[model samples]
Target chain A: MRLTRRDALAVLAGLGITGGALGLSTLDPTAADGDGSSGDRDPAETDLLATMTAAAEVVYPSQVTGVGEFVETYVTGRSRDASRQAAMETVVSELDEIARDWHGAPFADLAADDRDDLLRELGVADSEPVPEGNVSERVRFYVVNELLYAFYASPTGGRLVGIENPIGHAGGTDSYQRAAMDGGQSDVNAGENDG
Target chain B: MADERARAPVADADVCIVGAGPAGGIVAHRLAESGQNVVVLEAGPRFDGDRREQLEAHVRPGLDGPWEMGGPRDAFSSSGESFYPLNAARVKGVGGTTLHWQGMVMRLHERDFELDSRHGVGADWPLDYDDLKPYYAEAERELGVAGAMDNPYAPPRDDPFPMTAFPPSHSDSIFAEACERLGLDMHSVPSARNAEPYDGRSPCVGYGTCKPVCPSGAKYTAESHVEKAEAAGARVIDRARVRRLEHDESGERVVAAAYTTPDGETHRQAADQFVVACGGVETVRLLLLSESDRHPNGLANSSGVLGRYFMDHLFAGMGGRLDRPTRQNHVGFNTSECHQFYDDTEPVNGVKLEFLNYAGPSPVIDALHADTWGDELLEQLDESYGTHISMGALVEQLPRADNYVGLDRETTDDLGDPVPEVHWSIDDQTKTALSRANEVQASVLDELGVDVEWTVGPDNTGPAFHHMGTARMGDDPDSSVVDAECRTHDVRNLWIAGSSVFPTGGAMNPTLTIAALAVRLASSLRARLS
Candidate 1:
């Protein structure tokens, strides 16, 4: 009844097995998709990671390269529920189909501007929240918030704003204003906040 | 006896104090020093000095760990529609709940005593401010409270604080500027934390982790007084849970107390004097548990006011983000107070503006899920991190007889004791006060040039662990539970201390007032012992 972003995707990906209802032919998985490459992780699960990374690159471009890979690895490593992991695979595969239809390429291979344009169309830029919606809004949720969390979870992402280590990482800003107090400067106007 | 959990076989004492907490510490110290043998029972063991550091956290005490929180399922919200956090905020070790107090010490307003005269609601205290003023001074000295000697906003006092106030942080500057712009009076909240080395304790390092647990012991915990009480010839028996009070045949006098060991051994201690210093909820629970045919409703229930008129300040929360990046000054506990709204208000309502130290993760979490990401996320963090500030108005709530804590027959603790069920819902008066508090906070936020984020008031008002009333102190036996001396009306030798005895909770933090009352009760106990 209630499906997570991942679950909806897995079910939609399976729908491509029947062929051409929503023109989701490319979203169908190959025989090798669930080959269980790394320590029993299904190949479909691996592809889901790749799709998540591609979505993250849309949010934070791989400016010097490897940022996308970082996003993929970080997002994949966070374990949700194996019970719904199959659905998550479907979601990721359907994303590839959408990207192929939009730009005639895999979601990960699309140009940065094209990705942003697609994200905008998904209404990620709008005031609406992602998780609050349904299967109809799955792709946008995956590309925007889900991918963004994966990207931000990485150390490279943390470095972008000068938080050397965020919570769930290691070490942190012990005193945000102690130095200012020690220096006898009462008024402070400049400082970055790490949420 | 830090973490030692001493099990003394002895059962005789000149005085028996249930709950080795703030009230217990002060009473034990005072009475034991006067050469009366004292036995203090503690339900929870103290954290070893070495472990205390590890136990300290930046989070609120309730969220820290399971070990720090003692006692039954903290379910005071069992009935209240309001969001009062009864169980999470309170601690039950040797230091009691003061183990995690933020140390924002302030005296009750002078007119706080005559609530009946001022607002025609809530009963007036049997004694006036003058009666307790001297004891307040003594408590301040004992705690080595730090504040401005000539603070304009405070009530008149004979002497200045023992220590000067800490230097203002960036947060203080923001608050001061806003107060000045709005023509409001602001003052440094009196801190129990030492500004300089006093009583062999270190000063506050501004670690910003005062709540939950203070590692350095810079912020005073009742553990300090527990230690003092021990050194001055009192014994604190840790993990000795006092479940019942045994009285004489007529149920007019408390003869002894029965407590259970952690391993299920029951022990009884006989004493001439008994004081229930186990905070508001537990003290009332103990009295109710001691019910017998002679006192069928509950011990000291002849007045039928054993647990009623519960009160806590209605805190209205208003938050905002400044247009420009500013260093948020919440490194220490909330230090600034806008008391301009405190005095001259009707007894039914008064407001005190206090800022809460908040380094919110909301912006970062929002960015993580928003239209922006990567470099833009970083930019947003830089612009918004320290810019977040909260202005909370602690509005006074008048005590009502129905908002109470009583025994729930259906529920039981681990020891098969009835759990205290709280029935609290904010009244119409509280709703009006919350609206006023919200408006004042919004106006103050407007002064600081920030868009108001949200308002917290009666609509979503939280139930509290800051428990008061239940066994309130007043002049009459028919209308109240205790007298001016904090002695239960039905029991002559039995007394109760802490905020539970407060007839009216003034628009300020209650620790100082609790300690002041304990000192006053200590004086009374000394006279009785003599």
Candidate 2:
């Protein structure tokens, strides 16, 4: 049966889940299952993923989840990547300028596969002389990581990747109940009532 | 008039106190009540609840940013890059950092104080849980804690709490039930936030912004004690940054202290005795700055251990997805905790874990998480905002000499004072402890039938705002900065208060313990005066 947001939330609540996971389940995109991993993607998605993985491995060599698809998905959704749009635009502009210098064409006009290769080259070039007004490589890495980490580690990403959101059942007394039960006599509670 | 005149800057008082946070506030209140004329010198401005602009400046960027001591126009560049820790915005005001603290009060279990005796590592404090019990009780009464006293995990105390535990928010109830089902001992977290109309303060409105400053006065701050001290006739000076302590040629006694005011004028205030209640970092920095020919390595550097053994709690997140939705969109930020991992007698020497209750990431904070977003992401955010469970462990860090704080020669604040250069690192024991805690967290989530996601690692293990131990206390002057009474070994008249005196970084929050220690010191000073 089709589930509405409210209905899904109720089911989640009934099942004893709470917080961001419930919100995410309700907003689950119809195209999520298209790629069998909860979102729609072009058939060329595999190539993009491979490229992203290679770059992420170099950037966050110690990090285990170095997949490019995961990083792209995270940047597109959870991160404040859009807020860094101005910075992204500068990078894109520099890429276009580089393309014009090399092939006398705009970056967008290049074949999709070629575009990936060019982007990879830009990422790997340690000390390449790019246009003066372009974004720095450090800024690119910062933006990419910020987007990737937020999307992958957030409550939403936890749900998609089968990472359990611990808020629901990890053992503890709610502060109010502890306070109610203990009467707030804890050490920090000392000298609290002189007012 | 006679008392005021006699109390005014005598050659010396019995005890000179420093700082006015939990330790300083408590010490001052207890000593003043015992009839000691305690002089508290705070570098920050006096907190006026009406000062909206000053309060707002804390969150904004620049030198006078809310986290900064001077106003936004001041020069406060963050050294957060090399430190890998956010610069703590410490208030130089009367209340100290308590003015902008979330009052999650818990005790360092009996095992914590006896870490050396039990674990065969670290220096054991001269005093133990038993010695501090009465003081702890007195502090709780003064702080007006609202919690149950029957916690099995907590050490034994003499008296009960003033009031019953505050009611758990709707979200807390769900988390508590889940914990019990998993066989973990969950208890009410002791907070400085009010649960009832105690001592005239109102209950918390669940405003969520308890860090910068509690507008409602529901959270406990040293300002409340300052008011009490004022009512009892203790004089307080604000906007006065004590530059150094002046001594006579003999160098046997402290003559007076020199201070700088906000108006760029220098003034010398003569006092028979002095206390250093500035924070851990400042207290050490001040001593180092007060270098004299008689005592070269700063005020009390004879031992050469004035600023060593610094430590702070290392935090890690344990997150997972539950089978059902849990209430995440709740008002209260944290109301419950898992205290089962508190005691170290069970054989773990390095770290301990606690479960924090509450969910739903704020928009800005959500952006920090790279994994959870998009239409598919929104589905998870919505589903788990209230229903998800996230538990984190505030691990106990080992006392390493390398993790100490010193004055940074290159970076100076607006007043030309050197900013604190923190040198911090973790040892193998700490890493092992964190890994063990993470494993337990995973097991607990599995029991709840939720999908486990992120656990603590090198990238995720970051420093919390709760910084401590730059100036530690011990029985021997050769090994520590301060003594059991929070007095500096080098300067008899100089006392150090606040979490800086902590010999070992405990798993629980440090404010309550700091307050209790302060109160105990104040009482000691009063007795000596009498």
Candidate 3:
């Protein structure tokens, strides 16, 4: 199933969750369909996310599986103000246009290698200013990077990166390497001094 | 009647100390104990044990785990492109910034006192190491520091620490093993947090929020000294921000201090002698703000060097995944520390590195290391949690006249005063030292059998609230703001305390050194008053 950004927002709001970032619930165990699809979604959001996924995959291929979903989750979770919602919509539209212009075919239909080439070009092009009315290269780069960082750093993303969740306390450990060696030497010295 | 009603009468005292942090508090306590009428003026609100808990709750929302600021996050510097927020919790309470400090207390290395003599960089302190040794001992006793006095790199000491070092936690043990494998000496970290009760304060419960106010009185703060001073009949007025120094016609001595209460009511407090113990930034700010014809550049800035030579310890973190899961994941915090590389000198220069050990990756900061997506990332994170050892390096920054704090005309704080504009750029030599420290840290971690995952980029440099040397001390009044006694050269009765008087900040934390200096200043003030 597919979902539109608006539809996602409505669904999230109905569930009484509000924020600018996706939490654990969006990837709930029960919410997962047997086929690994976002079950029973409208066609519009799916098409939009598919395009975004294609563009993001080219930029960060390692994150294709979850990056698009996290971005959508973030956009939907943020304030329901028209300006913000419109900005998200514009981002989706620009991704679709960039994908189509880079490749002769629709983004979802492009091969992974082709997508990667286009993304590299976009990244390089993004280092400088683009023509007015076109999405600034830095903004595109930032959105892609932010999405990748936020997702990978998130709980689910951390699992993917192989970083464990909070395993212990912060700033509570003495873990200085010098202190440990000194401890051993001190013990030996204590024995020697005892004689 | 009209003139009398317009101005509040100045109340005289034996001594009036600005700020109530470590230095100010100690000075007040010592002076009051010496039967002097001491009045301490603190700009921050009064924070007792009960009020501390409330302050914690107010700040808890800001400490949303690691990688999050516990209060209103300040905007990133306009000059720097990095979005990573620089959050230094400045407590406007009686304890000052010590209220939210990690209670790591170590005296400045003996070599640190004579930087100019050794390295020919900054001016050597007028006083020598031996002169400050007794005061260092007194400060340690007052703070109830716990550690082994057997540090090879440490300077000569007359006595030992009050208590034994705190036991190493699980992570600390693993890190210690790694240090041992690398042929580096490690020991229990010396901390201001009580290992066992000494004074009236309780021992540290190992609560993770040491950067914030400690709810339990385990951590020593300036408020403790304030309490002692008050009990000895020293009045401490909170929320009183001193505006300027009111002087007589001679301009050689400070007659009184004009301060504004929280209600914006102005009053003048007269004293026989005045001491400016306000922290580095505020001390310089106040001096510069107190402009008069006698000293145009600022009080005690005759050499035209009042606000110069700012320094802060530069910190860098390097981490990698361990070969196997150790007991590091089992503990709340680490207790072991590494100081082998502290005085490690190259062919040309020496560099210092202090080990910063944590039990686990903070929830938010851990994300920086995670993969963009997938099950493999999760697996890696899980394995790394127990098997990872990260090393943070705190290197000494050379004092440069360029790095300074001044009032920003454009920016202002909530109080309508000009916000402090910090202009600090490290030199190539300091940058080289930082890089070398990273190299040593990585080598140490690798020797521990940890898989090299990633290191943070080089441009990620920020001060950790340990700002110092804005008002440095030197023999010459023209080159330095204060003299060896921390007294402003221009104003005979005016004195500056805390790290502001430091000519150079060593690699170690500055709290202990500040406390020692405060005690020394107290002695000087006591002799004068008596």
Winning model by TM-score = 1
* Top lDDT prediction, candidate number: 1
> Model 2: how many Å of interface RMSD?
14.0
lDDT of 3 by residue, B1-530 (tens): 55334234335689998898888888999898889988887776675424233422422221133222223212213222222122453565588777778788887777777877876766688888888999999999988888886577677898889988776554556666667777777666677877676688766543344566554456777778888998997888877878788777888999888887756678888999999988877787777777798867766677776667777776767777665544333223235555666655541134445544453454323333332223343444454455566766676777877777666657655555555556677667766777887787787877776766766424665555687889888888668878887787778898888998898887888899999999988888778777
- Deviating ranges (above 4 Å) for candidate 1: A1-195, B1-5, B51-67, B70-77, B357-384
Indicate whether candidate 1 or candidate 2 has the larger lDDT. Answer: 1
Residues A31-142, candidate 3: write the lDDT tens digits. Answer: 5553123574445446645655555554442533544554455443432344534454565566557777867676567896775555556553333322123454433433
Write the candidate numbers in order of decreasing TM-score: 1, 3, 2
lDDT, model 2: 0.57
Q: In model 3 chain A, where is the ten-residue run with the lowest total lDDT?
A: A186-195
Each candidate structure's TM-score, on Cα atoms with residue i matched to residue i, is 0.72, 0.67, 0.68
lDDT of 2 by residue, A13-87 (tens): 212222253344323323345322335533333333333333344333232342343444432232122333344
Better of 1 and 2 by DockQ: 1
lDDT of 2 by residue, B11-32 (tens): 3333444555666666666666
Better of 1 and 3 by lDDT: 1
- Sort order, DockQ high to low: 1, 3, 2
Decoy 1 TM-score against native: 0.72
Residue-level lDDT of model 1, residues B1-530, one tens digit each, is 42334565345688899987788888889988889899998887876543233331222111246245634634343577665566675787888888777787888887789988976777788888888889889888888788885457678899888888765555656766887888877677788887787777876544344666555557787887888888998988888888899999878898888988867778888898899999888888899999998899899888888889888877788887775434442344666677777775543576778766553442324454455665566567656565677777787778988888888878888888888877777888878888888888888788887777777887876643578888988788887888888888898889998999998897788988999999999988899778
Give residue A194's lDDT in candidate 2 (0 to 100).
Answer: 24
